[model samples]
Structure formats: structure tokens, C-alpha cells
Target: MRTVTVEDVTIGEGLPKLIVPLVGQTSEELIKESEFISQLPCDIVEWRVDFYEKVLDFSIVSSFSKTIKKAIKKPLLITFRSKKEGGEKELPTEQYFQLYQEIIQNGQCDLLDIELFMPEKEVSETIALAHQKGIKVIMCNHEFHHTPSMEEILSRLQKMQDKNADICKLAVMPNTPEDVLTLLTATETMYREYADRPIITMSMGALGMVSRITGELTGSSATFGSAVKASAPGQIPIGELKEMIETLKLS
Candidate 1:
């Protein structure tokens, strides 16, 4: 897989990148929290704006995101995960599309997360718009119930690559050890077979925590870590994640 540059950060070509999420309720809290997280070992920061109290207000979201951009030196990825995919709140599809469109037009973020489960047309338009503005698009799929077959997972990743996604990401919940193994297998298979840019894959929850720590061996290029709080199920703290990645490299 080739490296994708977002601002000064180059992903997929070095130690697996650690992405921390920002999930604050108010604008002031978000700004203060981002300032603190900026000093961590985070290579990328994702703003999970679905958790924000004023997410529906375009001005507030954009302003607060720009404030974070100024506060953090690492690359910023604006993400509004949908409620269907284990997000904090529900977002109607049309409203979701419009919000992302506006954000991409603003050009504040280095990357954007567009869920693959969204309507194809909506996803396509967002991808096209982001690419046109030179903003990297992270096409993502999240399945919190069960891990799909390796074939299905690979196919979904291939679809994201076909759609011109700069990165393809998938997170699934594992019910057993075999399910975690399946996720790792699918991640390696997808990166070997279909990945062109970069791939971020992990199985969520305690049983699947190993996936987050083993990305260097699994061919994944990035993993999530907690900053102020963990947005996902199996995120390790940023400090611990950094130490683990370093240990993995030395081993």
C-alpha cells in the first residue's frame, strides 16, 4: 500500500498511526480538550462530532473544528459517525449528507470520514467533492454486531478502493476468539489483495483489543486510541497505545 499524506503526516509508511478521537459536548469543552490532546503521541485526531451538543449547527461545528485545527499540530479527520453504526446520536441521511458537504467545502479538515453504509449516491458525491478539494476521504464501514466472512470484508474494502477512497477502514465487533482471528485474516487479506492507499481494520471490544495492538503485523496502517475519552469500544489510551506500538516494533 502507498502512503497518503495529510498535512505533514504520512500514514502507511512508518509505525502504525494512532488516531485519537474528540467527543466533547460543548464548544468550549471541545476546544480545551483538543488543546490537551494535541500534546499527546497522537498522529491523527478525529473529531467525532456526533457527540457534540451543537452538531446540527453548521457554523458551530465548523468553527469549533477550525479551532481544533489551530490547536493541534497533527492531521485532523472530521467524522460524524451515524447512529446506525454505534454513534452517539441519530442523523438523518439527508442532513448528514448536507453537513458533510458543507464541511468539505469549508476545507478545514485534512481528511473526512464517510461511512460506506450510507446511500451510494450520497457517498459518491461526498467522495468526489472531497477529492476535488484535495481532502483525503476515509471510506469506513462499522459493524458492531458480528464479524462478516473474510470474502465479504475483502469485497467491501475493494468497493471503497474502487470509489477512489484514500483510505478504507472497517471496525467489527467480535463475539469469540475465532471472530477476532477472522477480522485479522480479513485485514491482512484486504491489504494484500485490494488496498491501494491504506487500510485501518480492527475488531472492537475487550476480546478484540489485540487487533488494535497488532496492526504492524496485520498490515493495517492505523489504529484508534483514546484521548479525552474513547469513542469506540476497544480503544486503548494514547499513552499505552504508543508504548505498545513501540514494543511491537522492537520485538
Candidate 2:
């Protein structure tokens, strides 16, 4: 198994973790969010670039990356989620992939998240390009409606692993407590079976909040929380999440 550190925060090896403040669309909003994130105890800071007003402009992203790197010393993960994966934007697939490649080559982000649903050729190329530049690739899948069967979840995880992803992340919507259970069960199963790459598993929405906070128990490498606002449906505030993680550690 390979372990990675972003800004001195080690991920994997059962480390309890925190990722604060999902960034918004506008540069001003991201700047404001960075101020708030600096006040929180977070391990990683993610910029959800899909929300940016000039998302297609590689130069704008490069400039924004410089500002974020200077403002927050934490490890950064840059993501431009497609509309198919529960994000707000709808860029053409080719353009989106090009932008992602450009950011990986020119931006300062430590990690880049590429959705798993992208065409296999494109996904492979993106992963290869990211690796060439020494950037970690997080191959992610998002299910906003409902959790799939444990078998299906494992299949997705394996696919990501086969693609040489440094991390495999899946976020599914849970309609009931049982749905949350399904996600955890799959996380544990994948961890035990694969035991190579790190995996991030979460269930979204109010009903799935527990899975987000306590997923480390089931082998999740990290969890997400809001510093300014949530990118997902059930993200708790950073302060509350920090308290919960502390309590969990003591217990």
C-alpha cells in the first residue's frame, strides 16, 4: 500500500483526518472562503473549480491556483466536476479534459480529481499526464440518487484501482440508515480485499451524515466538511466536525 502526505498531513494508516471548506465558483468567493478555511484546523483544502465563473480559461485557473497556494499552506486538491457527477457545470467533455490536463501541468495543486465516468481513453490519458507531473490522481465516482449494491461499489473501486489511481473515491446518496450501512460495508470490504491504494467513501444528504464523519472506522482515508459552505448535501460545519473527530479519537 502506498501512503501520501499533503502539507505534512499523512493520509492512510488509520489517521483521523479533516478536509475543510469546499470552494465556490467565483474568484472573490474562493478568496473569502480561503480566509475562513485558514481559521479552521483542516488537513487538506479542496478547490471545486467546476463552480468558477471562468472555468474554461486555463490562465484564470492558474492565477487562482497561485493565490490559493499563497493563502493556504495546506495540501490542495483541484476538482472540476462534470454535470454528470452532481456538479453544476456542463462543459464539453473534450474541453473539460483539456482544462484538467492544463491545470495539472501548470497549476500548483497537489492533487487532481478526475471523474471515473469519463471515457476510458481520456481517463487513462489524464491519469498518465497527472502522474508525469508528480500530481496525485483521485479517480472519483458520485451517485447522488442512491447507494448501489455492495458488489457494484466494489466493482467501481476495483476499476479505479486498475487505472492506477492513487486514491479511489465514491460518494453516494443514502435514503435510509440501511443505505449508509451499505456504503460502509463496501468500504470495509474494499479495504480488506484490495489493501493497496487509499479509498474515500461517503454517503451524502442528511440521512448519510454519519458515514461522512465516521468513515475512517471503515477504512476511509479522509472526510469532507464545510468551512464556508458545503459542496455536497450533508456536510457539517468544520468546528462541529473537528469536535466530533476529537470525541471519536478519545472514545
Candidate 3:
């Protein structure tokens, strides 16, 4: 798979890149979180905009985006996840697209996370806009209910690739050990066979925590870690995650 280079971080090459999410609800909290994240040994920082109280105010959101970007000095991934996919807020479809457009035009973030299930035309347009501004797009799908069939998982990933996303990410909740295996099997298959770009796959929750640290073996390009609080279930603390990933490194 071809690697994606954001600043000096090259994903899809070595151990899965570590990504920490900032989910603060206020400007002060966000700034404090960013300061803390800046000191962590992480590869990328994601700003979960839905958690911010003032996220709907474009001017404030844009300003905070710039502040967070400057404070972190790492590749910034701005994501306003919708309520449908385990996010904090619910936005109208038009508003959702408009927010992304504004973000792309502002050029404050290094990457943007676009959901895989959004309308095809809007998703395509948003991705095009982000690319035009030199921002990488991470097309993501999250299934909080249960893991899908291996065929369904691969199909979702293939659709992400067809959308021209710089990176493809899938996060699902596994009900059993076999479900976790299904996720890993599909991820490896996609990486080995169909994928030409980086892909990140994980089975969330306690039952599938093993999937988080097994990225190297399964061909996932990046994994999420938590510094202060986890944005998703089963996110290991950054320090512990770092040590564990190092221990599992293939040399």
C-alpha cells in the first residue's frame, strides 16, 4: 500500500501511527488539551468538533481550529462527526456539507474526516474541495452496534477507496472473539489484495481491545490512542499504548 505523508509523519510504513483525539467542550478546555497533547509522543491529533459547544459558529470554530493547529504543531485532523456515527451532535445534512466546505476554505487543518455513508455527490464534492486545498481526507465508517460480515466490511472499504480518500478507516463493535477475527481478516485481505492506499480498521470495546494493538499484523496503518480521555471505547492510554506497540513491533 502507498503511504500517506503528512508533514514528517509517514503512515502505512512502520508501526501503526498513533492518533489522539481532542474532545474538549470549551475553548479553554480545548486549549489546555492541545497543550497537553503537544507534549505527548503521538503522530497525529484529531479535533472532534462535535464536542465543542461553539462548533456551530463558523467564526469561532475556524478560529479555534487555527489555535489548536498552532498549539499542537502536528498534523491536524478536524472531524465533526455526526450523531448517526457515535458523535456528540446532530447537524442537518446541508449544514454538515457547508461546515466542511468552510473548513476546507479556511485551510486550518491538515486532514478532514468524512463519513462513508454520506450522500455520494456531497461527499465527492467535499473531498474534492479538501484535496484542492491540499488537505488529506480520511473516509470513515463506524458501526457501534455490531460488526458486519467480512464481505460487507470489504465492500465498505472498497467504496471508500473509490471515493478517492487518502486514508480509509473502519471502526466496529465486535460482539465476540470471532467478530474481532472477522474484522482483522477483512482488514488484512483489503491491505494485501485490493488496497493501494492506507487503511485503518479496528474492532472497538473491551471485547476487541486486542485489535487496537495488532495493527502491524493486520495491516492497519494507524490506531487511535487517548491522552486525557478516550473519544472511543477501548482506546488505550497513550503512554501504555506506545509501549505496547513498541513491544509488538516486527523489527
Candidate 4:
């Protein structure tokens, strides 16, 4: 069976990378949204579960998981981002960890993304468990405030690598054009240094919009775009982003 390998999803390449938004706050709404998203030609659908009203309820999440899998044939990425990572919820760290473990154990997602700052031991355990269950772990870190220096950006990517992540994702907000340049440079450098592992690097915000769409040229394995409303700043609609990527290919 085909799977999302370290460097790419066997099914996700060549096709434009898709970013399905997670906007609904209720289970019914999310189910409806999942059905709606499934009709689109997205490469992946990410359930930003942090926005769900019943995020703490395992049963609700489990039900949503089954429904989403049934509704969408595309790869599903489940993420319950913590407040510290620019997410909406603020569950206790322990509770969040427990929820993450349960999702890995029971949720039917193809990929589970955990933040890099989670307790190291706990995070390692989660990665091991996910691998045991044939789920990919995407270790991610988001710096929503400002872009760090190239060196710092590279360090974060290395940290994710050390966590034995199937894919490494780093996002930062850029204050200046130079900052955006630094993020892309770091992405290129990491791709060259670790050509075996897939790395997703992007700059968020209006100033960094161009970087998000064009990262593929710099060796980024994937880029995110919104299908409905944007989850983050500078997210162009998926349809528009798809057209741009195609245009770039033809150029």
C-alpha cells in the first residue's frame, strides 16, 4: 500500500500540496465540513482539532475520526495545537498529552502532528507509538511572532529531525523581506543537508505570502493553503494557490 514516506507522500507529489481549513466548532459542523472538503481535489485534509468545542472528549474525537476517514479518501492530518503555538485552546499540558496519546492510539488519521516543545520524553513516546500503529508523525514548531535568523531556523529543523519525525515543519512570521529571504534560505540549506528527510518551511503573514507558495522551488516538500477561510495569515485560497503552482510549472 502507498504511504507518506519521510520525503513525500507517494500520492502527494507533483500534485499541488493542499491545506484544508478547520473552521467548525461543533462535531456536526466538522462532519459537514469534512464531507464538503472531500469533494475538493485537495492532497491532504488537516483537522485543526483545537477549534472543536468538544476537544477534550475522546468519544467525540473518535467519532469524528471515523466520519472523516469515511468521507475523505485523501490523507488526513490531525493536530490539536496548544495555545502557546498560536492555537485557540488552553488545556493543561498533561491533559493535552493524554489526548494526543489517545488520538494516536484510536484516531484514524494518517498523520499526527505534535509540537516540538512537548515534554521530550512524552513526545518521544508518542512518536514511537504512532510509528508502531503505522501513523506518520510530523514534528512541527511555529513562531508566529517573528522569523528567527537562518541559524536559529536551521536549529529548529534539526531538533525536529532529532525527534525522529517522519516530516519536519517549521513556520515563522516575517517582519521584513529580508526575514522572508532568511526563511527560504534556511529551507534550501536544510533540504541540501538532509536530502533524505522531507522538510516543510514557510513564512506566515502578508509579507511572507510569496514564500509560502514558492517554497517548493526552494526544496520544501509541501505548502499549505486554505480551502475556505484561512487558518493563518496570508493563506491564499486553495483554488488560487493551485492555479499559481500550475502556472509556475508551465513557465
What lDDT score is found at residue 181 in candidate 1?
97
**Cα lDDT listed for each candidate:** 0.89, 0.84, 0.94, 0.80
Per-prediction TM-score = 0.97, 0.95, 0.99, 0.93
lDDT of 3 at 8: 93
Give candidate 4's error at residue 16 in angstroms.
5.3
What value of lDDT does candidate 2 attain over all alpha carbons?
0.84
The TM-score-based order of candidates, best leading, equals 3, 1, 2, 4
- How many clashing pairs in candidate 4? 0
Give lDDT tens digits, candidate 4, residues 1-251.
Answer: 11255324452245436667666788778778888888875678888888889888976786678788778667888888889898889988788878877887777888888899889998998899999988898889999999999998888888898888888899999999999999998888887775457778889999999877775577676778887667878888877887887777633
Query: 61-158 in candidate 3: lDDT tens per residue?
Result: 87779999999989999999999999999999999998888878874998899999999999999998888888999999999999999999999999
Query: Whose lDDT is higher: candidate 1's or candidate 2's?
Result: 1
The best-first sequence of candidates by lDDT reads 3, 1, 2, 4
Model 3 stretches astray by more than 4 angstroms? none
Candidate 1 is scored at a TM of 0.97
Off by over 4 Å in 4: 1-3, 6-16
Q: List, residue by residue over 1-251, the lDDT tens digit for candidate 2.
A: 78876667778866557887556678887787787787788888888888888887987897779798767778889888889898878999898888887788777888889888888899999889888888898889999998999999999999999988898999999888899999999999998887597899999999988887776678888889887778889998878887887777634
**Candidate 4, clashing residue pairs?**
none
Total backbone clashes of candidate 1, pairs 3 or more residues apart or in separate chains: 0
